[model samples]
Target: MIKNFSKLALAAGVSAAIALPASALAEIRIGIAGPQTGPVAQYGDMQFSGARMAIERINAEGGVNGEMLEAVEVDDVCDPKQAVTVANRLVNEGVSFVVGHLCSSSTQPASDIYEDEGILMITPASTSPEITARGYELVFRTIGLDSMQGPVAANHLISLEPKRVAVIHDKQQYGEGIATSVRDTLEEADVNVVMFEGITAGDKDFSSLVTKLKQADVDYVYYGGYHPELGLILRQARQADLDATFMGPEGVGNKDINTIAGDAAEGLLVTLPPSFDEKEVNQALVKAFEEKGEDPSGPFVLTSYTAVQLIAEGIEQAGSTDPFEVAEALREGSFETPIGMVSYDEKGDMESFEFVVYEWHADGSKTAVN
Candidate 1:
């Protein structure tokens, strides 16, 4: 549930007052920030579910450093402005580590605050390269960057040997950024890009865009945006009898797209993190999520869980709750997580990450393209 920032502040102050004594400081607070209410709240659900489960399992085994974990969740609404507000709220509430601000647009700005305030943050879903390019020791991600994912998508498209392609974006940081990456990569491969266009994020009617695609006679159309707009575009393009195949990055890989596009979603290709839930090692954890009626297959779920596990392990390895020390530990250590064995470079970007292309189904299932 979303909470007013003012009310969160008041509660934080009261909780701080009652928990001031050293004896009462038996909780390690983890700030879970994301869109608790917004267009992308479904993605936020995966993030929250993963982090919360990690905390529960970790505390069940034995509290970290003999202190239980406490979750302090804040809704940024995926708005960059609101992200700043929630970041301050986290600092005020004394969160040592954070797992969130899912959208790259929000994550980038919120990270600035986290760095300045000494709060360690690991985003499970943000893919823009700029978030880690700033050399902020406190900022890290459990997912790959647009640079990695864009080329993967581009290469797959190249293998198709389409005569012409159209790349489209929603004009947002996460959307346009990845779209640009894909366009650049496709150009480098000497693929003919027929058109590169942008659409408003919340636009419902895409008839004009469909006409353009149909006029371009593009063999494949790549979209860089979230599911909502792309879903409408997919449905509209098909309605206009545009035969070009549609492809997108993880943002548009959501199942809700199926509701919007119906059978049109079936042929859409998506570049997403590998299905970690399918890994043999993660089956038990997958079962755990299923037991709770949570779908663990969304790309961000295990990544978020890994982010929380990394934070806890980093603290234990550093033998301190200090954010800086924990950040150092994260950088210096290699971890076996549900996503994979993860290690960070100097910028805290994962050393090696892969994005797989999957064919989405109308029923919300996906099969990785061989």
Candidate 2:
């Protein structure tokens, strides 16, 4: 009887051990939000690819302080309203850090949610200056703001000395904001603003606008919007036989612009982040991205990789997974990333960055303007 009892006790102990929760094996979840299924999906793809490369490399190197990193993607559809929903989901799921919501409109709303939930958000591409100026401690960005790029593009236009410059937008937060900035900067520089107007995005036809521009005799057209709207305008303008140089902000930097506009997208002048992949500063990250079959053409790719690196560094500095601690570390910390050295001011904007002018060739390739 005693021998039978001893065996039963041992059997019960083994069963309990087997059923114990293996919580330690769960990965540290980081939220990655962006437009996964929308007109701006390409931006999300670039961001996700950059993040995946960084996460894979970091995990291979043993991850953040031995804790494996896992990214949870939340598609906000690039809409501001959806961004809030995604933000809540991430917070409820206990994700302490986030990277995303590529559009300024989306990023702005999502940032409010993150701030309220105490989650740290580092945007790799959202350039609306208003995002960081809100004084949200939980929000940060690794790229230059529209305030910077607007002047850079305006200066590039000044160099060209176009007889008449026309500024227009798609009426979205990003488009209108950038248009306002560019217009104001050019006006301050005494550059003639021949025509300024806002068009609705996704309009299939812009013939009326193009006809008006042709009548205005605009020499150079500065557009403030993404490629879809800009592409259509350019294509329609060419179809109408209007000859004017089309210039835009970094919003027009995707290859899809040319795909949509076809031959009309030729000679598109825009301002974007200096080509980091070509610089020695991004050698390591560039090699890793190439190994994973990811193209590094989009400037935000390096910035996204750097965002993850910054988060890891912040975690290490804070010595905790607590969101507040990590955010504190990020605010006061400076870390070298793929793009360059990254540090945040009290407003959570990058302390170092400069814009560059680029020209899109007829073949959908970009070249930095000298």
Q: Judging by lDDT against the true structure, name the best candidate.
A: 1
Candidates' C-alpha lDDT: 0.94, 0.87
Model 2, 122-227: lDDT tens digits are 9999999999887798898889898888889998898999888999998998888989999998899898998889998878889999999999999899999998
Candidate 1: lDDT of 114?
Answer: 94
- Model 2: how far residue 54 lies from native, Å: 1.0
- The digit string of per-residue lDDT tens for model 1 on 1-370 reads 3568878999999888877866447789999999988999989999999999999999998979888888999999999999999999999998889999799999999999999999999999999999999889899999999999999999999999989999999999999999999999999999999899999998888899899899889999999999999999989988899998999999999889999999999889999999999999999999999999999999999999999999999999999999999999999999999999999999999999999999999998888899
Query: TM-scores of the models, in the given order?
Result: 0.94, 0.93
Model 2 misplaced stretches (Cα beyond 4 Å): 1-26
With a 3 Å backbone cut-off (N, CA, C), the pairs that clash in candidate 1 are none
RMSD of each predicted structure: 6.0, 3.6
Q: lDDT for model 1, on a 0 to 1 scale? A: 0.94
